[model samples]
Target: MSDIEVIVGRIGRAHGIRGEVFVDVRTDEPGRRFAPGGTLRMGDKRRPATLASVRWNRGKLIVSFAEAPDRTAVEQLTGELLYDHVPEAELPSEKDEYFDRHLVGLVVRDHTGAERGTVSEVLHLPAQDVLQLDVDGEERLVPFVSALVPTVDVAGGFLQLADVDGLLEDVE
Candidate 1:
């Protein structure tokens, strides 16, 4: 298997006595990533497991793995990160869309072509996606919107952000 792994979800807590666990999905396509019969890796070690079942409960996802047969078994998996080795070629081809893996580590620059920082992470919120940047040892959360982030030149290894006053201000 490839060394590259894309984190898709984080196991929350054991939901029921039958080993079902709630998952905080991190991928845009939860249905595909958390689908039954899909295989997912756990943690940095990449422990392999196959999804025995997947279902929705109270607007959240509940998943069961073949390795986890009871609440006691799944409880041990709580807080574990789930990952899939999705190749770059399999990423979405829609214009102006990018995978989180592609965005991370890209240089961030202002409209005037001044270097600001590097993308450290991508936060997927319910309202919108945000880019987490590491600037001068400080973290900045920039909204990933067209108005604010005008260009994403992945090939060029950089992205341009519109200068928004107070947007990059340090937050306490």
Candidate 2:
């Protein structure tokens, strides 16, 4: 239950008859996250399951765990989230790359130094990620791309957002 554990995937429906399950991956690095022998923590239960095998099916990752050996066993894992229980420090160090967990709860500010709100959530969309903020009790969706976000100072505890016209307007 540590904050350091990052969600790597969510178990979908059973893929085939041999206990293989389709995973809706959340991480950018699927090969590492879903690799054989990698251990993933299951949702709520926090049960550690080792990846016994993994295969790519039409760009989707179908995985089998040692704990789940049949379709019936994999069925129990449907809708469960898979997390990589690794410390943030152990993650790859790359410029401008950040885990969504680090951005949550950070104060979001406009380029003019005006406080917009606090980050409530981080939405990972197919095209890009978004920062969901709570401003004056209203929700705002801000694209997390460099062009709009510009800066993220986790140590400083704030996110600097570029001024995009009507970007902070109330959602209708």
Candidate 3:
């Protein structure tokens, strides 16, 4: 199996007594990632399990594992993160879109071509995606938007942000 695992979801509280659990899906392609019969690795331990069923309730994804049969079994998986081994060559098909793995570790530059920081991580939020930057040891968050982040040169290993007031500057 590939070591490149992508976080697909996190197990939430149990929904019923039949071992079904709510999942906080992290991937954009939930239908494909959380499909039935799919193999998912549970938590940091990378324990393997197969998806026995997947359904939606009130717009939330509910999933059950073939290995878990009862509420007691699924309860143990609460708060556990789910991951799928994805190939490194696989990438988003959108022209400007990028995966969190691809965005992380890239150099962050300003509009004037001045280096600002490095992308420490990508935050997937409800409203939109955010970029966490390690700026001179301090952490700063920049929304992943075309208005602010105008350029993304993945091959060049850097992304440029617009020089907006208070965007990356110190606010007094």
Q: Give the better candidate number (1 or 3) by lDDT.
A: 3
TM of each candidate vs. truth: 0.84, 0.88, 0.92
Prediction 1 TM-score vs. true? 0.84
Mind sharing the TM-score for model 2?
0.88
Candidate 3 Cα misplacement greater than 4 A, ranges: 1-3
RMSD values for the candidates in order, in angstroms, are: 2.9, 2.5, 1.7
- Tens-digit lDDT track of model 2 for 6-56: 889999999879999999998877876788998999988889989999999
Model 3: per-residue Cα lDDT over 30-56, one tens digit each: 887888998999987899879999999
Q: Where does model 2 exceed 4 Å of error?
A: 1-3, 91-93, 170-172
Which stretches of candidate 1 lie above 4 Å from their native place? Answer: 1-3, 125-127, 136-138, 168-172
Worst 10 residues of 3 by lDDT: 1-10
TM-score of candidate 3 on Cα atoms, chains taken together:
0.92
Candidate 2 — what's its lDDT? Answer: 0.86
